[model samples]
Target: MSVEGGAGEPLSDSQKREIAVWFLTNAPAGEIHYVAKDVRALLGDDAVYEAAAAEAFPEYNKAHLVSLELPDRSGDIIIATYGELDRNNYLDPRTAQVATVDHIKQTCTKLRPAADEELPSAYIEEFRSALDVELSKYVAEAYPKGVCAVYCTSGKDIEGPGADFGFAVVISAAKRSPQNFCNGSWRSIWTMDFNYELQFVDIKGKIQVDAHYFEEGNVQLDTNIDCKDSTIMQSPDDCAVSITNIIRHHESEYLSSLEESYLNLSDATFKDLRRKLPVTRTLFPWHNTLAFSLTRDLAKELALGK
Candidate 1:
């Protein structure tokens, strides 16, 4: 497009060539459209190509001024008061108001080189390595079975290899804790991957013991039947057996309880739980009430007989 103005002059072939070269070398990618508009306006259609010529052969107009359109969608354009026609003439938002050689130098300092450093990709790789190390440590300490499964979760439940491992740990742990007679009891295992990804396993079961009683009038009685109470002493073997039985008998209940609990958590509370879980650092940064609600539900389910 050409701009209409007085003192119109036909642009020389040399000037047109210069303007094209300046745009190819200095304009940001996909930004030449606005640059062309601005250059056409300042030089008028007749001498619009002069801007390009001027950029190539600075000797043409050492004191010539050029206009540039801002990349923002605000439709704002700026005129370069004085400078060689090149990227150096580009005005940055920071020094736009104060026009000076020094300001141009400062803007140049803020411009990024066109080379890609792959920073984001490198960061993600490092984070993943660290997460793997951490998960290995947890597996060694808690799940000697070598983390049979693992899962990853974010804004919503995500099923994967990582999540499967986490579920296994939950089942194993549930088979080890004491049960509650009033309801049930549970223990949860959680892991955080790098970038704040979270993984969790829920273990739920009941513990049973026998009750003893003494009659007041010339009679004493003790019941050997299994009862859900902490008052009676039971061997470790018996405890383990009770836990395994509870897990097998109430597997569906355990899952259902977790689902119900998550449903009850408010959005804010769920976020807090995700933050509080130590596993967040190893997992991607995703927080929601669903995770918290699940944990709460497991706690309630375990407390059933308590």
Candidate 2:
């Protein structure tokens, strides 16, 4: 657990741990055992609220804030909480912002314990919205690079049909590339197909990545080839076999459909074929150009050759 909130009145380290434990154990239940004021006191006046904020939401450091989930027997509900810590004043010794605390309290008040009468679907949207806000906030803070890996229980239709239970590693590295990487173009490689997107009701554990990099092109592909054989080159001629194998190994199911639809006999046939596929266009926005690569490159970069 880590302290949260603003600079002057943040929660202490111990308090943060305690709050995190409590939230983990008693989530999805509109219940808060510790009082905000009490947390404020424990953190000491100098860092009271900030400490409490950190403890109440360790995910802040990682780019997430704590949220409370309250489910009625018939419906689910949630509320989000955020610290008063401003990025501009991150290193300053300012006190907690009163507005932040008020906002949290107001959000919390809207939630109520589960009741037996409401329909399950009645509050589903509301619950999801609240959860999203909290989750997004936490993720944004914790993973400024927008990369995260989440692990969850796997099962066959855990929630309902078309639902497969399994842990997921969410790697969100969607950031505006620096000028050197793309002349100010916002490029990223973690985009996903509509059907491949993941949904989750609850998440636990800290998100971690092996490495992060900023390069001109798809560093992920580069790293993948490099890992298999250090001599691999960015040019197709230099690593034709490796590149071919890589493409073959990671072939998209949609590629088959595209190839069949457009039968052109030329060296540039594959490129043309790919351009015609909506799936390919969406997933490979860079069109074989510079794009962010999360795991493939990060893993190799961390494993060898610095």
Candidate 3:
């Protein structure tokens, strides 16, 4: 297909050749992303889809920016490292809003709140009966006021491996406050590649969350929290003590299994890629209410096959 030129001057043949070369040589595998903003502005979405199917650019999913047609493009085409769009000229919400709000609404309809959804009923009954007490005891001793309640929640793992086999327990705070006090969680998930995250969340602040995971056998420990909380503001240092408290409180078979999963991996290559690497990730916080509504939509868009 002879793709038409962009609204403004589309990337020239030389520019396209240079971008493709740069991507091959320098860009990490499968990191290149292309949006339809330029072609869509010039022609329309129909044309953009045609372009998306082209071999020159495979597709990236759920980028929030590249959901469907990028809202607008300052320049017709983009070719850069990961998150280049969100970097300079394209950072404005008006410029890079993900597929419309209606697009998200239509997709998330009839969807139970992610927070409300429980792991398949059988799992919830078992988890509550087995581990709730230990979790509550741990939380109570760890923080002032401790935990008021703990409940199970179900969600698919966004990365790592497949759908979770069980529910995650939400440790609710005894002294709840709108601004400061927030809940915490101990989530054990997976069938084959078992993984768990013990997280502290500030529901009052948008995207206020901190997570910790100790790879089995104390081989590794990863902290996955939004850096904006402490790293950016330079307030409290990374809360290693919180993680110590969470794990120190509960010593259970379930938590042990999660540790084993992380510990006993056969893939030397994958292990090399993961050895002792502290995983501090940026938070994609969308309140407990929004949960996975938009994520589900973007997964559908990219055909991520969940």
The TM-score values for the models, in the order shown, are 0.15, 0.19, 0.20
The lDDT ranking, best first, is: 1, 2, 3
Give, for candidate 3, the lowest lDDT window spanning 10 residues: 227-236
Best by lDDT: 1
RMSD of each: 30.5, 21.7, 20.4
Q: Give candidate 3's root-mean-square deviation (CA, Å).
A: 20.4
Question: Candidate 3: how many backbone clashes?
Answer: 0
Report clashes for each candidate as comma-separated counts: 39, 40, 0
Tell how far residue 241 is off in model 3, in angstroms.
13
lDDT of 1 by residue, 1-306 (tens): 332234796555555555555753443212234455565655555454554544432321111122232333222122232222254443222222212122211212223211222111233323333333443343334322222112222212222232222111121221111121111112222232222223222332232211111111111111111122111112323423333343333433444544464455454554656364334344322223222433444444444522
Please say which candidate is ahead in lDDT: 1 or 2. 1
Query: With candidate 1 superimposed using the best TM-score fit, by how many Å does residue 148's alpha carbon deviate from the native?
Result: 6.4
Index of the highest-TM-score prediction: 3
lDDT of 2 by residue, 212-273 (tens): 22342322221111112112222212222332233222222122322332233344534656
C-alpha-based local distance difference test score of model 1? 0.30
Off by over 4 Å in 1: 1-122, 146-306
For model 3 the TM-score comes to 0.20
* Model 1 deviation from the true structure expressed as Cα RMSD, one decimal place: 30.5
